[model samples]
Target: MISLKNITKKYGDKTVFHNFNLDIEENEITVILGESGSGKTTLLNMIARLTDFSGEISGAGQVSMVFQRDRLVPHLTVRENILLINENADVKRMLESVGLSKAENLYPKELSAGMARRVAIIRAFSHPAPLLLMDEPLVNLDLSLKFSLLEKIKELQSTTGKTVIMVSHDVKEAAYFSGRIIVLKSGGEVILDKKRVSEKTLTETLLNGQSI
Candidate 1:
């Protein structure tokens, strides 16, 4: 399990989060929803150990992430990029898992935005990380592609049982994809907390974090 206590972050005198506390089940997927500047990305960063903080944090797992921006190696083939992390059989299994088994030889520039995003996701999941974090992973994909990829993501998670934390601007998507939804209001207050509700209810619904 992951434990966060009194987690607070500030830039100079402006506090982004104050005394925030959260616990994430070790193998369960946790989806975080918030508007822009709501500090969702900041929270993900802190969880990934990419940012410093004052609150205590603890976990027993390897972590990897797919950021809002693709961090592909421009000069490397898709396979090579993923192999950079796995360096073994783990790469082949992950590629097949993400539906990218045929695009192994392609370079980043040769692929579309959605394709690149899939490659990044595969790369992150190929490692030994027990926790995976994603930030707006489907932002550039068309609806059909997004739907397809989301399934692929879910399949990978179900297969691996790795903990997932995704930060997304689309609450509907968050509700549909995650088992638990955490809504962070401005100033880091968790105004909404809901547990697995039927996805049909969140199709056009604006969840206020009280459903949980």
Candidate 2:
């Protein structure tokens, strides 16, 4: 399990989290939902130790992150990028899993957005991290492609048994996972937490601004 105790984060005078605490189960997909300034990304960064905050975070060892953007190297091919993370990474096998076998030697510029995103996913999973943090990784995709990537992520999580923490704004996307779901308000307050909640109920709860 991951334990976050009294997490206090601030940017200048604006406090994002004040004595906040949350425990996340290990080897499970946990989707965090919130508005723009609800500290969703901040939380992930804290867990990844990418940002500074006054907190005690444990069990987040060797985290790999997929940011809002793909953040791939423009000069590198899809195969090279994944290999950069793990020298022994099965480049062809990983690409084949995501139907990118033909694009192995293709640079980021030559690949479509979805393909680049898939490569990023493969890179993160190929890393030997037990904790995976994804920040809005599914944004700005068509419904079909978005769901397709979601299924791929689910498969990776199941196969790898990594503790996955994903930040998402879409209710449908959060509901897509069978693991735990956490909803946060602007000040980092958890308004709702559940497992395998229906999409309709989640939408209604978000709209009503009520805790469940």
Candidate 3:
């Protein structure tokens, strides 16, 4: 389990999270949903220790992240990117699992936007980490592709049971997880938290900006 206590973050004089507290269970998918400046990405950053904050977050050991942007090495091929994290990784099998086998030898420059995103995802999952953090993992993809990638994520998580925390603006994406869904308002406030919810209710809560 991951425990966050008294999380207080600030940028200049504007506060983001003031005395915020939350606990995330192990081996589960928890998606953080919120609007802009609602501290969605900031919360992930805090957990990954990419930013500074006054708080105690325990049980997040050796975290791997898929950033909002696909931060791949331009010079490396798809297989090389995954192998960079773990030399013993089954690069071939992983690529095949994600329908990226044909692009294994291709460099980031040669890959389409979707292929590069898949490579970035494979690289993160290949890393030997207990916690996986994804920021906007499914952006700019078609509906079908988005759900397919979500299934891939589910498959990986089931096999490895890594604690996955994702930040997303898509309610349909949240509905697909069938796990913990958290809706945050401004100041890192949690307006709704549920394990299972229909898209209609989730949309309404997000639109109303309050718990129903």
Candidate 4:
């Protein structure tokens, strides 16, 4: 398990989280659900130690992250970019998993948005990290692609049994991928923490702004 004790994060005078705390279970998929600026991403950053905060975070292993943006290197091919993180990574298998086998030698600029996103995800998952953090990774894609990637994510987690913490505002996504859901209101307070429910129920709760 990963525990955060009295975490306080601020950007100058603007505080994102004030003495907040959370515990993330190992080998489970936890979704941080919230609107923009609700500090969901901030919390993930703190967990990944990508940002500085005043608190104690323990029991987290090395983390691999997929950002909201596809941050693939422009100069390198998909396989090369993935190899940059893990030389022992099975580039061919990862590419095939995402249906990008033909694009292995393609650079970031050569791939479409969805393909680039797949490459970014493959790169993150290929890295040998016990904890994986994703920040609204399905934001801009169409519904079909979104669900495809969602299934792929679930498959990866089931196969690897890695701890996954994903932050997203989509209720359907939270319901689909989360074993546990932490719903945050503004300023990083978790208004609801509950086990997963049916997609219809989850959608209603989110639509009505009701906390479980």
Give the per-residue lDDT of model 4 (tens digit) for 7-105.
999999999999998999998889988888889999888888888999999988699999999999899999899999999999999899999989989
Candidate RMSDs in order:
2.4, 0.9, 0.9, 1.4
Give the alpha carbon lDDT tens digit for every residue of 1-212 in model 3.
89999999999999999999999999989999988899999999999999999989999978999999999888888888888888999999889989988998999999888888888888889888989999998899888888999999999998988999999989999989988999999888899988988888889999999876
lDDT of each: 0.81, 0.92, 0.91, 0.89
Flag clash pairs in model 2.
none
On a 0 to 100 scale, what is the lDDT of residue 129 in model 3? Answer: 94
User: Candidate 1's residue-wise lDDT over 122-143, tens digit each?
Assistant: 8888878899999988886898
How does residue 202 of candidate 1 score in lDDT?
47
TM-score of each: 0.90, 0.98, 0.97, 0.95
Error of 1 at 97 (Å): 3.5
Residue-level error in angstroms, candidate 3, position 150? 0.7
Off by over 4 Å in 2: none
Model 1 poorest ten-residue lDDT run: 203-212
| Tens-digit lDDT track of model 2 for 1-212 | 99999999999999999999999999899999988899999999999888999979988878998999999999988888888889999999999999998999999999998888889988999999999999999899889999999999999999999999999999999999967999998888989989999898888878876787
Candidate 1: segments with Cα more than 4 A from true spot: 198-212
Taking all chains together, the TM-score of candidate 1 against the true structure is: 0.90
lDDT of 1 at 17: 93
- Candidate ordering by TM-score (highest first): 2, 3, 4, 1
Question: Can you give the lDDT of residue 199 in candidate 2?
Answer: 91
Positional deviation of 157 in candidate 3, in angstroms? 0.6
